[model samples]
Target: MYDALVVGAGPAGLMYSRVLAAKGFKVAVVEKNEQLAVKPCGEGISARVLKTAEIEKSDYNRFISHVIKGAVIVAPNGKEVIVKEEGEMGYVIDKKNFLRVMGEYSASTGAEIYMKEPVKELTFQKDHWLVKTRTMELEAKLLVGADGYLSFVSRTLGLEKPGERKVIPAIQYVMPNVDVHDPDMTYFFLGNDVAPKGYVWIFPKDGRLANVGIGVQGAAPKAYLDKFIKMHPEIFKKVDILEFRGAAVTIGGMLSEIVTDHAILIGEAAGQVIPLTGGGIHTSIAGGKIAAEVTAKALEEGNLSKQRLSEYKDKYNEYWGKRIKDSLKGLHAIEKLSDDELNQLAEILSPEDVVNLANGENVASVAVKLLKHPLFSIKLARALLS
Candidate 1:
């Protein structure tokens, strides 16, 4: 039996597998797809993710498509607020190559990765799990579910599938040879008409290439994205669609229970995503590292009980749990505002305030700023402060 069986060979599974193997544990990662990063994504990530994943500068540059300075937040009425960071803020990565390198690192540490092998069934027998794939069956002492939003492993764990109320549907087109206003800066468009309850984003990739996408809560995302492209002829005129795909992102906060006896859930399966921006790349990478550390301790002690495994949740919470909760609060507060209110909010919010609020760092500063506006009363400000 293997020390751990990791489902889904995405960044999370591969990362933890690498860590476990490095710690002298036998780990196996099984993936459904033939290749990695086939899922639709904006592929944007902060520099912190690279540090957390322990990738060297040369390897990181291999998969980095663009260096991002910051973003331009546009209001409904066409007003724009430029949020610029002092240095390299983030990167739009070539995710396929990134994941491949991660897998290579994991494999080098003696972790077995099985691709194109979807998990057919999971059976818990005694203290081990019998995982049946399309071609073979394997048994392991622990099961790690790093599978995504529609994770089969999550269902087996008796967790509720992310419902429409908990997820936002997003669609993106890889537009090559497109004329973007600024290739180094990302763009965020905010308006109910533009994306209903969600927002639209234009993240530039390499030269003349961008990922243009729209995420909406209650309507068709592709239709909205297409309409936005048509209306913004200055940006999307003469653009060629190289690829397009749709995906659902879970924004309902992390699940209360992510660990059970001999099993753990990480990545989007457990809602390890930023609720406000639907960003999971960083959080998931961090979570994978934490899960590996916790699981390794449990193995050394010969204890795989739910209580022992629960330490993984505690460590993850200590790291990013509060930030995620705060982001959910920020999302809730902004979702209640009308387009006019958002426009007013944009005018009053400085770039630093936007950064702080999005990161769930300085709520008091933003609350104070909002209180000056008559639209946000003492009650709303208090709500934000709380």
Candidate 2:
């Protein structure tokens, strides 16, 4: 029997396994996928994740494809504003290599990894959890669901019922495209026809290659992406499609329940995602760290009950709870805005404040500047005030 069993060997699962094994716990991770990090994402990750994890440059360099400096916001009316990073903002990394390194590092630390194994069922007895796989069965004192948005653990446990949370359909093209103006910059496109309530993003993995994708609500994401490509002839020209992928993102913010008797949830499975920007990498990594902290202490104290494990839930609230609630207030409030209003809001954002918005540092600095516009006075007053 293992002390901990992590389902879905994604970044969150590997991160937890690594930390748990480091703390001398017997940990095992099982992943459904044969290959790692092939999940569809924009790959524009904030350096905040590295900072939160205290990863050094040399350590992070193993998988980085390119370093990002800033971003561009394209308005519905096609107006554009650029936001440059105050410091090293983030990177567009080779995600496959990053996942491989994380998995290997976790295994090297004595954590057992089993790939190509899908979790068939998770049964909680009086004391331990029985994780049944297609090939074998494993038992663990603690069970962690780091699965994707559609989590099997959450379902089996009856955590969030069907329709309790919302997810957006997303699709992307990993291709050799010539016209990303700055390899150091990412781009965001906002408009109804563009992506409806969601947004489209372009993140350069290298000078000539990029992940151009769109996330949309109430429509086909592929249709939106196709239209976006047709709109940007200059960018999509000579685009040699290397890969095509699609997935769903949980944007309902953090779930109300993340823990139960002898079980805990983290990463996307717990809905630990930012509603507005779809930026979950940093939060997912942070959630894993939080899970490890609580998991280790519970194991040490020999208290695997949910009453004791509730410390993980409480601490995560102290850390990310307010941020998620506050950000959701802003993200959901914006949904009432018309496409023209969104364009106006984008127009109101100056370069300096745009940078602040991107970093999530003192957004009030931009809000104060936004008050100067009469349109902002009418439309975004409620969102900014709250």
Candidate 3:
């Protein structure tokens, strides 16, 4: 029997397998896809997460945009506010190469990797898990489900639905040859006209290449993406379409029961994506590390029971609970702001506020800064109080 079986070879699964392998655990990673690459993503990760994951800067293809000096916010009325950040700005990654390097690195660490093997069913029998694929059955002492939003392991484990608020739909595209300057500065557009209940982004990868996307809360995403593209003819006119992709982003947060009886859920399957930004790369990586550590300890103690797996929950809560809660609260604050109010708020805050906002700071802090601007304060106060 394998020590650990990770269902999904995405970043989260790979990270877990790599960590466990390093600890001398027999780890196996099963991926449904035939290969590793940018399957579907926004293709951006903050410098913070990169550093935290210990991913080398040289491992990725670099396309410096604006040094991410800060984020620029465009209100529905075309007003703008630029917020300067406190530290090294984040990088827009070449996601395809990033994934390839991650896979290679994990394999080099001695993790048994399998592709094109979709897990069909999971059965818990006599203190172990029997995982059934189309061609074979494997037994493992522990199981981790990192298989994106529609996680089969989660379903098989009988975990509660991630809830409506947790699931978000996103549509994204890579546009080549766009006439955008300061590629390091990420841009966000707020207003129902642009992205109802969600937001639109322009993340530059390099000189003229950008990842443009839109997300909507509890709404069909294709229609909104088409609308966003149609409404921005000026930007679209100068850009060439490179690729298009869409997927669900878990934003609300994970359910209460993330681990039970020899099974654990990580990544999007556990609703670890940032609520406002829909960024999951960092969370997934961190979650994988935490899960692996917990799994390793449980295996060493020869107890893979629910009580032992509870360490994963405790560790995650200690690490990311506050951040996730704060993000959800901030999303509520943003949701309440009217289009004009949001535009005005964006225009009033400095680049620091923008960075803090994107980095998942407290909404009250952002509110206080906006209150300093008379017009924005009035608009925001009315929106919040009403």
Model 3 scores worst on lDDT over the 10 consecutive residues at 60-69
Clashes of 1: 0
lDDT of 1 by residue, 103-137 (tens): 99999999999999999999999989999999989
Off by over 4 Å in 3: 37-39, 62-69, 85-88, 162-165, 218-220, 367-386
Clashing pairs for model 3 are 65-183, 65-184, 66-183, 66-184, 82-351, 83-350, 83-351, 83-352, 84-351, 84-352
Best by TM-score: 1
Candidate ranking under lDDT, highest first, comes to 1, 2, 3
Shift of residue 324 alpha carbon in model 3, Å: 1.1
Output the lDDT of residue 96, model 1. 92
* Model 2 poorest ten-residue lDDT run: 354-363
TM-score, per-candidate, Cα-based: 0.96, 0.93, 0.89
* Candidate 2 lDDT, 1-386, residue by residue in tens: 99999998887888889888989999999988888986798888877776765555677878888888888888888888987767877899888877877877788889999989899988888899898998989999999999879888888888777787789889989889648767788899888888888888999886589999999888999988988898788988889889999889887888888898889998889888877777787778778888998889999999988788888878877857656665565667666778888877776777776554543445566567766777775555446556
lDDT of each: 0.88, 0.82, 0.76
